[model samples]
Target: MAVDLENPSNYLTTRVRQAVNWGRKYSLWPLPFGVACCAIEFMSTVSSYNDISRFGAELVRFSPRQSDLMIIAGTISYKQAPILKTIYAQMAEPRWVIAMGACASSGGFYNNYSTLQGADRVIPVDMYVAGCPPTPENLLYALTQIQERVEREGLVPAAVRHAGRVQV
Candidate 1:
């Protein structure tokens, strides 16, 4: 069944799966990969006014092993691709990635040879927030989308990386 994030009350599912997803959606530990102008906007999302904590993602973890979501909020150079992949590899199962800007999503205006056209070239992106520097509200919206997807997927982890690099 399709579970709408805005109104899950209308949907029904097995109690166990619902319970698990309930806990998971309310507790998403995000790891911020900030490296450019968009990083500043991302910080604003965690500020008192925007308060990312309200979404249950207040615990911004630096360790990949401890985080379930990764917010890539800047341009990714080829030099940084390996590092990004390494951190992603370290994250546990059911991990999510949000490309939080034009730069992170498609390298923005840095269409140079050194810059990676998109983080998706090196990692799988679960969500993409457009704009040279997307507003904090957009990031928060992306977060909600992640929660929605998590709830919809139920007990099954969808971000599993298979040998063939399939994103299911």
Candidate 2:
């Protein structure tokens, strides 16, 4: 097949799509909202060991206002649940939440009392990373999942939860 470089119709849509895809492929900054123990693992994932920079997520924002992803790490106490909810709400649209650690995902051993049953009770979690305190490798895996989710959904904010039960 001969290439038609001069024709306006030739590969115009393809070129536009490629450019859009390339821009979206890069530039994903995850906001680490680590409250406790799992924070250590979160740090390692971005640090020298796991090296999250390779995936273009090296810039982990501490402020929810500037972040597109919120990583809820460690236990969400009753006292902290409101704060977490507020923070997640503050993040820009097209944001994602990763519930890291058993404590964050299911409240771990603190199920009986003050801790929240799960971070999901407070925010819409996109991914659940299991562990009393998930390892750096697990955190990276969770990050990869978040990236895949972003690519699949595009830039618009999709609410996975509406009024409690999962939105279908």
Candidate 3:
């Protein structure tokens, strides 16, 4: 192949930072914190039927220490809030969180004091999927939204930007 000095198309910027971000966007290691009925739907989203792997998020990491993406799938009682916060703190940097259903987003129907109004109160959420127990499709859509956001934002830490803005 003849080299063209003036050609922009011949170059693919492979800077170390951008290269890492590219991998992070595609190979999101999800740590599912499934708690209730929504957990069931989360399962379907990862199953062979829906195949979340198509988005490069197939490997589900049970250990928060090893994962970058956290999906909170159900209600969080007041007593559990602290625990959730601890777990969030344990996860490595460049982590992103997905509040996967109405319950995780806003405590669903548990409007009482025992249930935290939202998981966001404890940890910042990068995406929210609406539904009592959102459909697998909705969850998939949420994943795509997260991917797009990641693409736009690169390796920006969700905690730094949204730490003070986790109102939802």
Cα lDDT tens digits for candidate 3, 1-168:
877989877776577867776677898999999988989998999999999999999999999999989999889999888888888888998888999898899888889979999898878987889998999999989888988878777877766767568632
Off by over 4 Å in 2: 1-22, 160-168
Candidate 1 residues lying further than 4 Å off, grouped into runs, are 1-14, 158-168
The candidates, ranked best first by lDDT, are 1, 3, 2
Q: Give Cα-based local distance difference scores for all models.
A: 0.87, 0.79, 0.87
lDDT of 2 by residue, 1-168 (tens): 989889987664446545664566567778888889999888888888789888888888988898887888888999998788788778887777789999999898886779899888767787899887988888888888877655655665746433355432
Model 1's alpha-carbon lDDT is 0.87
Which 10 consecutive positions of candidate 2 have the poorest summed lDDT? 159-168
Show where candidate 3 strays beyond 4 Å: 1-19, 166-168
Please give each candidate's TM-score.
0.86, 0.83, 0.86
